[model samples]
Target: MVRNTLQMIAAGCGVLFVAGGAIASPAEVTVANAERRLEAGADISMTRWHVDAELILVLEKEASRKVTAYLQSRGRLRVVDVSVSINMDDRVILADFGPGFLPGPDEAEVFLHELAVTLRHYAEQAGLPIVGVDFRYQGKPLKSYYPAELAVPPRARIDARNQTALVSASHGLVRVHPALNWDYQRPDAFGFREDMITPPYGDALQRLLEERSGSGVNRARNRSQDPHPESNRPWDYMSSRYHLKTLLPDRTDIWNSLPNDTDADREVKEDIRARPLYANHLGVGTMISLHTNGHELGAIRGVEVYYHGDKPDDRPLAESVLCGMRELIRAQPGYENFPARQDASPGGHGENRIGTMPSVLVEIAYHSNAEDSVALQDPVFREASMKGVEKGVRLFREGKTCEPFVLQQIPDISLAAGTSQEITLPFAGHPQFPVTMEFTTANCSSPGACRPSKTTFDDPNTPITVLMRCRGSLTGDARWSVVLRDVDGVATAPVEFQHTCSKPGGSPAA
Candidate 1:
């Protein structure tokens, strides 16, 4: 089954062309990474930083205990600004920030997904690795924030688990090596020795896969062994506390199980499209929908990156993932970046059709990878993945690039031929933001069309209400749904709602 996967060059520097590796002029120490110099320096204040676009080009949003290490340790690599995104939870991604010249000025711009995609192609062609950050705010541009010296967020904390290392901060970004964990539910135990550094998840997976292939996916034939033996590592405070597990499989299974003709995917798709994060902001455009990619059976091994082919703008972002994966695979000393996509197939259509949508579905590694089992069983991956998820969110939300909270609580479902009841959904955003709510319905025919009978903004989280109005004449209740897009149009994950058409009041034809 030609699916959405791609392959390329042998182990080379992955997408993140950090110094010390092949990518040429390695990233030398810079003022940003100079701790003592920075500490003794003068007062540096942030000017402005905001994200107004859907995509942003950045090196990555890996974190450190102190801003000094983040920008300085790497040298010459002053964090012009890492492209990040924020959801209900703050998260960021290194790749979302991708390989780019990096941001400068009072700020870096996070364009809406549409605009970024349209223009990113030119940037990618020039051998650029910069990808886009997903911003959730309602079209907010990251304004310049400061004296690069002063404005940087406090140094982030760098920790390791099950041979996995993660640099993170409380509401900032965390760039972690993929060995951390492909599945959020799992986390490795016993951090990797300092000698073991995989570029990111892509690299880590390749390493583990290799050990297994050379030996076998099990305890009997393996050669490499866990260095840190902390079997009872405490629950990751952040992940466990927030329940930041990957999206439950039950949900995806249900989604895939539905017949294409079902109203479910249609309503949700409309909701997803209806709220293209930056659709409203003249400055903002489209977003590269980033999610914890996996398979219906949770059996796939590589990251399941999905991108919308319908949209030409997504070309660069799509290409970056495909190519970057290969680079990362080669960069990691150990590990193997396996491939299994429709595009990789001999008769495959090509790169154009890899994702379910323009979005990239990156299932970093199989939660089931044998090498990762010890780590995964250790449970470090959850915190590591959570850091990644948060980094992905933060890469788009940090600084002025922050998008107003996107309220995507829309739902699609069918109703009985003639019934009308009550329904509810979510309102994603900070409680303080002055959020406006609205809903509408379409595509009805036959005996009776179902509509929102009544809705109440009971809680602030999900706040769009619509009263369904029936007109057509069908048999059972007509199909209907609810949507709560942000002013910018970026929507939230969708849920389903169905109402009957047999109302107490005679088939009201409003």
Candidate 2:
């Protein structure tokens, strides 16, 4: 796989040389020189800063090719392309993977780790002074994973009965790393770490396999009920067994878990445990826990934003984020029907009860449904979803309310078969700026359809017209539920329209 990746990188180098213009001397390739060229109206695309253009081109080309090849080898063909850039000020290398690179939560985590390692090795070989690697998928920025720092030996142990990995590093209190508790459920497995199932780990078994000779599936079977007898340290076990390393001490935290004894007991314990961390980390702005929902009914879909009910300060932030996600989803194509909203009830989960700061746990669409899974995989959808949360954060920080955006229901319309009827629906919000709302029909007796005359509402107070149409040979009493959504894909209460279609000779009635 490495040889093939290298060969592909070599192939890409040929293309880069042919397309990349003439290379400049090292003296002329400084950051100052690049800035001067930019000031003189040189195309930004044609300039390279603080590095030789040809070398940068070669490195980027090779990195892109190798990353794509690496993902392909892991049975992922979603990554069509990759682009790498360097930030001179931060001394960080950023790699942006094109759409479809990450199909699921599991893939996203793995791709980042693998890509980081690959880029780090290449950067080291090229004598580049990069301090960290930042990643983006489909234009949406993701968390940065820095190289682990060398730490003096820390005391660590495994609680077999509790299925927790306890690490008592010198800098902080004892941190409990729960095993296989991704959904905050009681641990059932022995070998899996909480991080392994949560964000950043990707597929822990796959990572372990990458370091070992055998297949990941086969190696995972050797899950020991306890940590290696020889290595009492958690970090040691993680490195030697799963090839995993810790992020910076400041960035790391013990996974929060509530005892399953009782609701009151769990809440009291969670408060006591979380308050200290919150108080100490006063600089921490907010917290977001990522999760996906599973339901017996496969039809459940859309994004749910949850905030602590007890924390009134977090309500606005949660609402803002919810609005942002809804608007983003609505603005994006193919996600018009995707619903994003604040959960009606405040979240009572242990993670949400972190009292020190505003916290939100986003269930990024339902993973139970087939359609939602496909939507989740789409890079555009994923990017918009994340941007919504970010926009919410920005708004919250700026003390701006996200309540300006609103959608209103249009009156029901009855239309004849093979015919169309137009009706106007009035909505009010953000009067000065244009707002776009997508009109869609769902839960129809037949396949009811509706199209808005103008999706963009330039004048907020004015009514927008929608053309409701029905087509199909056989039709009786048809009930069509119209969902009106704003740019963020947040829908107003759906308005049900009743339409009656008679035979061609018979008159249509409402």
**Model-by-model lDDT, in order?**
0.28, 0.46
Poorest lDDT segment (10 consecutive residues) of candidate 2: 164-173
Could you give candidate 1's per-residue lDDT for residues 127-211 as a string of tens digits? 2222333422223222222244113222123211111211111110111233332122223323431111122332333333233
lDDT of 2 by residue, 1-510 (tens): 543543343333311111155764433233233334433455554434343344455556655676677667766674466677776455467777776554331123334433554564444333333445666666764322211211111212212222111111101112233322112221222333222233321223133223321222111112233543333333322321121112222322422334342332232233233432332233234544544544434554667776654465667767777777777666677777575532222433434453355656666665556776676656677666666655665566557776544446545554556776777765544322355555444444444333332367666456666665556655556555544555444455556666566556666543
- Candidate 2 regions exceeding 4 Å error are 1-282, 342-344, 404-510
Give the TM-score of each candidate: 0.21, 0.33
State model 2's lDDT.
0.46
TM-score of 1: 0.21
- Tell me the lDDT of candidate 1: 0.28
